[model samples]
Target: MSFTQQLHQAAQNIWQKSLVHPFITELQSGQLPLTKFRFYLLQDRYYLVEFSKFHHLLAEQAGNPQIKKFLLQSEADLRACEWSVRSDFFTGLKITPMEIRQTAVAPTAYNYVNHMYLTLERDGFAPAIAAIVPCYWLYQEIGQKLAKVGSPVALYQTWIDTYDSDWYEVNVTHILQLINILASQATATDRQMMQTAFIRSSYYELQFWQMAYAKERW
Candidate 1:
């Protein structure tokens, strides 16, 4: 199987959980509490800060110019979104910049982002990229699924559209290509390690929704 296919097969159960997860179902149906979504947004901002950092480091360490270029662009996209959280996005919701700044990372958020950092620090760029791919790929898949039913609520529909856009699918393809390229040269052991990283991160992605559902803190 292609490396991307192998990784997908390995994480099939996790993807199924993510697809049918109550938190996501509720969000799509406009049944999710705003407070829960607000909590998710808050933690997600913190998560993106770390994601941006991951790409910055990847850009620096990558030998291939294409990889470096992709990472740089990825970081820029994340930072642009981060910039919007305070003003364009959440301003009307009373979620001030200070409130976002003051919100502590929940345990799930901390573990997920920290795991990304740790993967890069411990295993170098390729595995780290593998580890983080599910966030984009799974979300892209979920977004497309969501687009079919399409939320009735304006705000929730906006979220769905954001993920369903062409840009995100491009990113999914780009990242998968990068991973496949890296996997091509990897030793059997290294490829297996990469698969492990992908599986573990996929698990964390599942937990994140549950965390939001429970409105976890501390």
Candidate 2:
């Protein structure tokens, strides 16, 4: 199998579990308590900000114009997404910036974001990209799947729409193309590292949802 295919296979179990996770199932049914989602949205900011940082760091290291452009775009998109989460979404709910600032990061969210930082800082592009791809691909997978289920809640519906937008395919295609290019040039050892990074990140994806489900704190 191609490396991307292999990566998908490696993460397949995690993806399946994530799809049926209590948090996701509740989200799809629009039965998730608002308090849980509130805490989740508040805590997610911690992850998104760090995610933007990793993209900016990658953009700095990118030599290829396309890679650089994509990384910069990714960073910009993440920042905008964060703003939407904090401003448009939260403001609609009357959550002030001060409130968000006061919200503590959940332990799993902290670990996941920190994992991205360490993986990108310590690894080459192949493994670094592998480490981050799950966040993009997994959310897209969950979002699109949830989009197919009609939710009574507007917030739940809009959240699904945002993540399931058509642009996700374009971004996924571009990133997969980049991954194929990187994989072609990678040594077996590098490939193994990439696989390891993918698995670890995928595991964290599962934990993140579980955290949201449990409304974990500290």
Candidate 3:
């Protein structure tokens, strides 16, 4: 399969295994709670910062000029998310910056993202991109679903606000563009390696979310 096709397929697999099949049933029933929604928002806020940091490292290491630019743009996008979370916290919504920061660095998801970055920084850009794809694609898919589900449904609005924002969309587009460029530069063997890494990373992403949601158990 072409690189884009492979990426899409991997993403579809993740959605099927993680969000679409699992949450769609609950969401369709409109039975998910506000506390759970809040927990998701808080969890996401913590995660995005780590993502931004990882992209910053990638931007610095990127051999391809286009990929470099995309990484830089992604950093900006992450910052915008940070700002939005702060806004949400300051609005008297019971959200706090410390809580977000603490959760971001929590042992489970935080450590996983950190390990992915370390692997990428140590291994190569291809591996790093592979490690990162699940986070990007999964967030996009979830955001789209939440958007369909509408607001005040327990974390739906906060999620919509974060994931559907211009900053988030731009980052997603840039990552896809970077992947396309990377695929073009890679030989068949390298492309295969990237594909494997992408699949593994995507699975890890699902695991992280599942773990986080389970831990919160709202």
Candidate 4:
């Protein structure tokens, strides 16, 4: 199996739970409370900032020029998406930068980003890729599925369409390809570490949805 396929297999249960999580289901149905979504947006804005740092650090450590280029472009795309798309989400939801600044990071998001940072710090390239891909790949998968069924809410649909796009898919595919290449060269121990990182990140994805749905604090 391809490295990414194996990572998916290992984390399949977590991914399934994420897909069926109330936040996602309610989002697809457009019955999700805007209050809940507002909390999510606030937390997500924090996440995007940390995510850019993770991307830059990973790219800086990547020895391969192609991988570095892809990581940089992926970070750029994330910035563009946040500015052009999520800025409207912030405005329409009446979320202010001050509110985002004032809000403390929810435990789930705080721990989740820390997990990525720690993995990158300790394990460097291959493992860091495994740690981070779940965020992009899982969201793209969710977006693709939800896009077909679609949310009645325009804002939610816009969110879905943002992830379910050609550009996003191409980035994900490139990452998957890179993962396989890295895996082929990885030792057995290294491969196991990568798998563990992937699964842990996947579990965090499920927790994140639950946190937002419950408006988890502290």
Candidate 5:
């Protein structure tokens, strides 16, 4: 199979077999409670700034022009999300920026993302792309599912809005296309290495979410 097909298949497997489906089911069932949801939003609000910085660095180092452009675009999207969350905090929740900053972050979860960025910077763009694939793929999948269900939940809207934002979608598509192009130019060893990195990154992505959910619950 082509690299795109392989990556898509891997993502499909993750969606079906992993915690993502269960988490979405929980959201659909309204089991997370408003308090937990609010906490999650606040936590993510702070993290987006760091995440955006990481992506900005990655985009600068990306070998493919298209991928670099997409990364730059994603930085903008992350910033917008950060702004939205901050606005909601002050106006909607009456929370202060200091409170948001002082909120306890899940170290393991944040570290994993940081590690991915470091890996990308150290290992090379192909592996970095591989490492980050799960986030993009998972977001795309979740967005599509939520959009299909047409749910009215605020959390659903949040997820869909953030993941399905034009910038996110464009980056996802660009990354997939770049992977295909790179795959064609790669040797068998390179392909295997990239695939291995991609799969490991996906697992880390799963862990990141699981850790975030667990930390917020605490």
Candidate 6:
């Protein structure tokens, strides 16, 4: 099995919880409150801002030219995606940049972004890649599944469609391949750090949903 496949297996339980989380299920059913989704969008805007920076930082550290190029491209894509989400949902919901700026980052998103930064600081590239991959993988997985059972709400369906596209899948596959390549050359200790980073990121994925559902503060 590929290294990412093993990481997926190890984190399957956490991923499953995220899939079945009430926040997700409610969104799927088109029963999720707009207030909750708006809160989510705001916090997500914060997360994606830092997430793009994380990619740029990772790209700087990448020794492989291919990987560095991919990371830089991914950073651009992430910035565009973040803006697209903001344009679509924020305008649709009448959320303002002022409001988003005024809002504080929720704990889940703050911790999740910090976790990625800390992983890079302490463990370097491989583990940092592992930490970020769940954001890509889980969204595509959720989007594909939710596309099959699409939301009646156009907004929710639009969100699902964003991740469900073939282009998004290709980007995700590229990163997973990178993971496998890194794992092949990684020391046993580095591999274990990667595994731990993957699991923690997966767990954070689950918490992000809960935070949205509760519109968590502080």
How big is the positional error of residue 77 in model 6, measured in Å on the Cα after superposition?
A: 1.5
TM-score, structure 2 vs. true: 0.94
Decide which is better by lDDT, 4 or 6: 6
Q: In angstroms, how far off is 68's CA in candidate 1?
A: 0.7
Is 4 or 5 the stronger prediction by TM-score?
A: 4
Candidate 2's C-alpha runs over 4 A off are none
lDDT of 3 by residue, 69-174 (tens): 8778767866766556656544546766576556534455565676677667566788678678767767777777767756554444564556666767777776
lDDT, candidate 6, 1-218, per-residue tens: 88888999999999999999999999999999999999999988888889888989998999989999999999887777746766888888999878987998999999999999999999989999999999999999999989998999999989999899877888899999999999999999999999999999999999999999999988
| TM-score comparison, 1 vs 3, better candidate | 1
Give the lDDT of residue 198 in candidate 6.
95
Residue-by-residue lDDT tens digits, candidate 5, 1-218: 87878866765565565445445666655565555555656656655666677788888877768768878877786567646755764556566767777877666556656767777656666766677667676767776766655446764566566665676677688778777887888887777767777777666656555554565433
Which one wins by lDDT: 1 or 5? Answer: 1
Q: Order the candidates by TM-score, highest first — what do you get?
A: 6, 4, 1, 2, 5, 3
**Ten contiguous residues with the weakest lDDT in model 2:** 78-87
lDDT on C-alpha atoms for all candidate structures: 0.86, 0.82, 0.66, 0.90, 0.66, 0.92
**Candidate 2 on 130-181: residue-level lDDT in tens?**
8888888888888888888757888888888777887666777777788878
RMSD per candidate (Å) reads 1.5, 1.5, 3.5, 1.0, 3.1, 0.9
Give lDDT for model 1.
0.86
**Number of the top TM-score candidate:** 6
lDDT of 3 at 48: 66
| Cα lDDT for residue 16, candidate 1 | 97
Q: Which digits, one per residue and each the tens of the lDDT, describe model 4 over residues 1-218? A: 67788889889989999999999999999999999999988888888899888899888988889889989998998888655788999989888878877999999999999999898878767898898889889999999999989999999999999889998898789888888999999999999989989999999889999999999997
Better of 2 and 6 by lDDT: 6
Superpose all Cα atoms of candidate 5 onto the true structure and report the RMSD in Å to 1 decimal: 3.1
